[model samples]
Target: MPEATEDLARRGDRAFLAIGIAVALWLVATVIVLPIVMPDGPSQAVTDYLGALRDGDVDAAYDAAGAERHDADAYDTSFLRSEALSTDWRIQSVWTSDDLSPYDAKLTGGIEPEGHETQPGVRVVNAVISHGDATSRGQFYVQETGSRDFILNPFVYADAGATLGFVDLNGVTSPAHRADNGDKLTKKDSFALFPGFYRLYQHNDDLFRADPSTLMVLPGTDVDISTSLSLTDKGNKAAAKAVRAQLDTCEKSTQLAPSDCPFNPLDDGAADSVDAYDHEYRDVKDIKWKVLVAPKFDIEPRDGEGPGDFELVPRNYATIRLTAVGVDIYSDSDKAKRFSTVCPIDPEDLVLTVTASKSFTVSGPAHTYAGRACGRDH
Candidate 1:
């Protein structure tokens, strides 16, 4: 009887060992193998969309997000593949819930068509995403088509407005007339974009530049992005050189008042009119001028104008030495006398127009003497 009990006990031990092996195999299949063969769920859809953007695959991203594609000619879609797209991103967490009402207040804040109620068979997938130094939480509504397969709701996008008139997105020039979403963008126009990261800046490297401004678009949100352009080190040097070249050209002229130049011998405060100054110097001859001090410029954009339109204003007066041989009209002498005087020129406004071809033109109104200057030799 004791031997029989020992046999039964051994059988029981073997049975338990067999059942443990079965459970282990089942766990491995459910945890590892099932996901490989199954279709993507709501969370996977969001993952695919963000991955496509990082890879610069616009078509894949559009398909993943179910967003409509606009014509390339009509819309400025080059930003999709631009280098400005942020690749430093990671998914912190993804949570799925059938009750979307809890997320409504946060996700739909500042968005149009507000106050959305919960729907049946739709799951709200909330993801915490981070890029560089910024992190944001966004929600996407997805519904299962079949089994694990799911599709994101259509027209799920965000709006981005900018304060700048003309801007460059990811090195691609985006003019003020057209937007990235095929809309005619005016001063108040906004771009409808998918959830992603974008960079805004000015592309005029020779004359103007701005720090790269970043925009993070969260789903169902209206965000504003802005950046102020300032003269680059290269641009400042170029502007100074151009102004000096213009002054040199003016100094080479033999006329008392060089046309389109910033300097002249006429005393603006003393002379009543340009005509009167011309009459006073009608008999002047052998006129020569030299730039004593070249004017310095502060490069800035013209008010209410787009990029490539700049105004160069002198911060200080420019001095010029003038020498001429003219008759002494006040002395009633017909004999010509050598006259030498110094005049300070005021270049308050100089227009510098930059074209698309990267060529620039500098022009200014003819400037008269800023301070008192004696017409006779000093």
Candidate 2:
């Protein structure tokens, strides 16, 4: 009886040991073999692409993204040489469409994998990538080869409502997406841009009449970027009116040089300095303001601020072009005069803060023009 009991115990122990070994083998197969044989999906593809970008291998990243030949090189150069330089970029999440029945709907031509028609597997992956403090999320549409290879299709796109115009953000040009019928620009209201900084007004003489505003295109979201030309028109009209109003003093006053006028910055304390001074050499004549071009506001972000934070800034040397002529002067003697007869006045960098209803407040001395260039008639 004792021997039979011992035999039974030994057989039970062997059975338990065999079960343990089998379980261990199963775990090993699941951990190693399954992963080795399993095919990579869109999530893995996004991970790989982001990994390439993080490593500063922009060429590889662009190839993975299937970007256009023209823009691919430019983006790569921009990323490495100037923008988006970071090594710690990491993928946070990936989202995809799971329905396999209609996988080829989003694929574009040329970049599609060979034999994709036969295999016909495609997926759109939206991935969030972070580097340091900046994070960007984008969509990538990828296609599978009939065999084992995966290729990226260039049709991956984002719809951000409308495009107002292009802005120069931190010296880099980016498009501002806005709503249609803004009536501010001559183009349609659809545009796209990679995440970056932008200025309100671009460098275009034709667009000098445009109001300036700061713009910022952030990552991971779609939004409308629009500004009112009405505000610009209002501010410009008000400012121009204000400046012109000041010049009107010159027209009303019989003095050769009006004390309230801002057309000239230099106060040389000459014979014309005295208001209503009698001049036997020349009588105070007609004064008129001729606006060669209407005023436009170019703005920049305030110090320690982004596109949303802004202040009026001048870019080109000339904002308002005009000829301010003071007629009626005897130029026989070269006597030093505080004001000139028949002088032309031009101003640059006319700074003003635009408010609601097209109103604006000027900065600096109220009586002094921000930029003044006055010369004797030649």
Candidate 3:
């Protein structure tokens, strides 16, 4: 009986050893294979793209994009370059993970805890070294939600200066748009830059068109918006009449070319109207207040100017002064000037918090626009 027990014990030990070895082999196989089976997503794309961008191979980076993003003829340099449209910037952080959202994966680092602010055109990495630096700056989400891609903005864009048709960001050299034309500009050809900052008057005219911040400030005249918008205040009755006329004319003029830009006439059909584009998605009238660009920025007047393509571009100059005015949805308390240091193109950034006494008073909105909007028309 003792001999039989010893034999059984040896056999059991052998079985245990075999089982352990099999498990070890399986574990090693998994270690070797799991990664091979996993999907490559935003992080991979972001890292590869960032590498290319850092190396200044924009064409290579552009090629790696998805189909819609890859369509070169339609989504060309201008589309990619116009992202510099926003000069104001902020950085937010998040954790480092192989599993990040497709949109969020385009970041090279983790999100940040404290945010850092800088002027619009500075790059993300350099912005960190600016006036108010931050730390542990993780993944960046432009706004509160995990959406807005801070890096894609012009500040981080590898070729923003090139996109602007300038050799660099400084003002020393004329932009390629200007240089290519032999510096000989025609009457109609001029440049239109989306404002570094601005506001849109609800009743300044018939149509509450906000795309071209100031409809036609005309060239050679330094029309301080701070003063001009202020002087033009009419009571509700006057405002209503003007709104009706402008709407009627806009609607009528727009009929000639449904494809023409409803506003911001590039060619005939670039309908860049904030109201017209968003007419169906959200009711423009339902919006509580019209935006007023705060006075910290300048817009060179665009009088006697027309559309521009690769050729004749309009050049406007502006210097931002930290001042703001209110867009009174309720009353015309003051109207002595054409523009006032009231309402800002971006309300959330800075509008006098103490400007008004009540919530019903003229405070900025959750968001504002100094941008051109286009879409599936309502």
Identify the candidate with maximal lDDT: 1
Per residue, candidate 1 scores C-alpha lDDT tens digits across 1-378 of 699999999999999999999999999888986655442377788778767776777788777765556522233343445354666666666666657644443343322222335445566777676777688776776665565434343222222333334455556544443243345654234343456665665346666664446666656444555445566677667766776677788888876777557655554532321122222333566878877777776877655343234667777776777777765455566776776666665565456655444445667754454434433324
Backbone clash pairs for candidate 1 read none
Model 2: residues with Cα > 4 Å off, grouped in runs: 1-43, 66-68, 71-83, 100-122, 131-137, 145-349, 352-378
Worst 10 residues of 2 by lDDT: 72-81
In TM-score terms, which candidate is top? 1
lDDT of 1 at 152: 43
Ranking of all predicted structures according to lDDT, beginning with the best and ending with the worst: 1, 2, 3
The residue-level lDDT of candidate 3 at 280 comes to: 14
Q: How close is candidate 1 to the true structure, as a TM-score?
A: 0.53
CA lDDT, every prediction? Answer: 0.57, 0.41, 0.27
Write down the TM-score for model 3.
0.19
94-160 per-residue lDDT for model 3 (tens digits)? 1224222233222322222233333232122211211124221222222222332233322121111
Q: At residue 361, give the lDDT of candidate 3.
A: 13
Candidates ranked, most accurate by TM-score first: 1, 2, 3
